[model samples]
Target: MQTHFNSEYPSVEHLRAKAKSRMPAFAYEYLASGCFTEVNLARNTSDIRQVQLQPWYLRDFDGADQTTELFGETYDAPFGVAPVGLQGLMWPNSCQYLAQAAVDHNLQFTLSTVSTASIEDIGQITNGRFWFQLYHPAEEELRDKLLDRAWEAGCRTLVMLADTPTFAYRPKEIRNGLSIPPRMTLRNICQMMMSPAWAMGQLAAGKPEFQTMKNYIPKGLNMKHLGLFMNKTFSGRLTENKIAAIREKWKGNLVVKGVVNPADAEIAVKHGLDGLIVSNHGGRQLDRGQSTIVPMYKLVPEFGGKLKIMIDGGMYSGADIASCLACGADFTFMGRTPMLGVCALGKYGGHHTFEMLKKQLQQVMEQVGCSKVSKLREHLIAESVPV
Candidate 1:
């Protein structure tokens, strides 16, 4: 697919700037900000940029290809859309829009448990080929029900969110009143009014809700109580017992996201998980944590063959994706880049972002004289500066 985005928004940073300009301040900050000082947030991308690739002029190579295989599935590209909660709040109907785009592009689209679209709806869009990310519910019955719903919808891969044992203290979110049962302050209202296009889109789409969890929420609960309900519904932390139970219940491929430690990766392997995504909740859950790329670099050599190793955090471009692959990541995922596209161009955002990333990755492969996605590691320069 060719990028429909013009030269003005040729890069992810460009799309992000446009997204910030087009979206309301509160919404943009919610999507953009990390917890507290946001040190890890900035480090995520900055550290990735530190990785340098060497071009080989002497090597002969055929046309570059970005096809990648993970968990028995072959994808057109090496990177996929990382699941993000409250996606519709960024752009109305964005979850479905992204799901459809992923299907059309033959890429993986993981749907969040807290996303605006329902499991069945996205299942229909992707023909049950999409991955489902689960936030462990407080109740076993609720967890079982959600799993059943996902399986019935034809979802085969389940990504269990392991980070976010506790919510991060985001000063921007607090000041903007973007928390649960969000406070609609006058400043926020004015910010929304300023972004007329975003306001109009929200009006047309109706209020964003947790479509997957709404069925379990008791009716007539006010926004404050609704917040309480959400808090009570998902416990955030996953224990060994909880993981054991899920392993027993879920017969399909199981993956644990938010793994930044080697010990945790070993635990997931012991638990028989099919894959592990080395992430730090996109730097939203922990402000002082190490950049995801650092841990990915350390853990890949230890557990690359033990299970399918993937990484997602701070990757905004195809070069970033290539860097992760060179460092030993089997696959890559990006959360905010695609949303920036959607927020910047409305319905055309997802496709344009995918195509742009594909083009950029293909260029990187050609420059390195690498022809296949799996061969990206061969282009890694040994003794390169540490990320």
Candidate 2:
């Protein structure tokens, strides 16, 4: 990978810009857009900026620590890659790229239910730094089988996304004529032709098929067929009862992702879940809903120690991770950064992306006079404005 801007391009925005140039327009939109209005998506970034960090100049800042522990495991950084569905649509073998990067960086990489690569494939790369996110399959037998496969793959944690009870209406996908497995219409062909690099990657990867769900479905299933299978196989609505059932099924570190409200966080605690990723599905679920930061102060304390509280959404810089920790997040998840890394650098991109975030977080910590990542709360200051 040739250097684009050699001062390290420390910010995720720079990496994203490079990624957008390499990727197709629909791929960029798929990773960037939110639901209707996109207010929540905007707020996720703006709200983080609102929280001010207090710097202690008198203290001697010798070294910086960016490590944190969650779910009985200590991660080298406070950030991990969040699960993204249809990642192959963005770039070929995205799940594998992200997982391998997470392993190289000593961070957790979550694989989505609808990811193109299978758990076994990703496990081979990172030796199972992979966390599987479930969509709550309609068929109990099939869902259990997938869980068993994840266990066999050495997955220690299970993340059940609680927010996406109903899939939000993404206008971009509809307008782009996008469906699962992807249809190559005139519009899509032009989009692909615009980015020969991504098109060639797809060609090499054999047309971006979903290996994760291939075994469950019949042979000769195309995008339209897979889309219909997804619609029929997984029920979006996940109730408390269903969660309880899941708790009974899986004993390992169970995480309830997509929590925005404090009450729902309490429900997760009551259900004996190990952790909660406070997020608005990265603004993909409810556009009008509040950003994850808006409810962090309220929800973190509500279930911080009893259950680890993490966040994801609108995080494009290391300062964003600092802001999340200062506000209330125990750990943060990088949804697009690692993908952007792979997009920009291919096999080694994920490693570079993780290093960039780690460097940024270290700089922020040293500047704020923090020695350990856990001491981030010591420097936290709630402004009259918002952080």
What TM-score, over all chains together, does every model reach?
0.96, 0.94
Candidate 2 achieves a global lDDT of: 0.80
- Cα misplacement distance, residue 116 of candidate 2 (Å): 1.3
In candidate 1 the C-alpha lDDT for residue 42 amounts to 95
Candidate 1 structure quality by residue, lDDT tens digits, 1-387 = 454656678898899888999888888988898989999999998888888777788977778988888878889999999999888887888998889889889999999998889999999999989899999999899999999999999999999999978767878877876643346788978888899998899889988888998888777555532234456778878888999999999999999999999889889989999999989988888888889888877788888888999999999989999999988889999999999999998887898889889889998999888888888888777667364
> 40-119 in candidate 2: lDDT tens per residue?
88888898877778889997777887777877777899888898888887888777877876776679788888888888
lDDT (Cα, 0-100) at 174 in candidate 1: 70
Worst 10 residues of 2 by lDDT: 1-10
Please report the candidate that would top TM-score against the real structure: 1
Clashing pairs in 1: none
**Clash count (model 2, backbone only):** 5
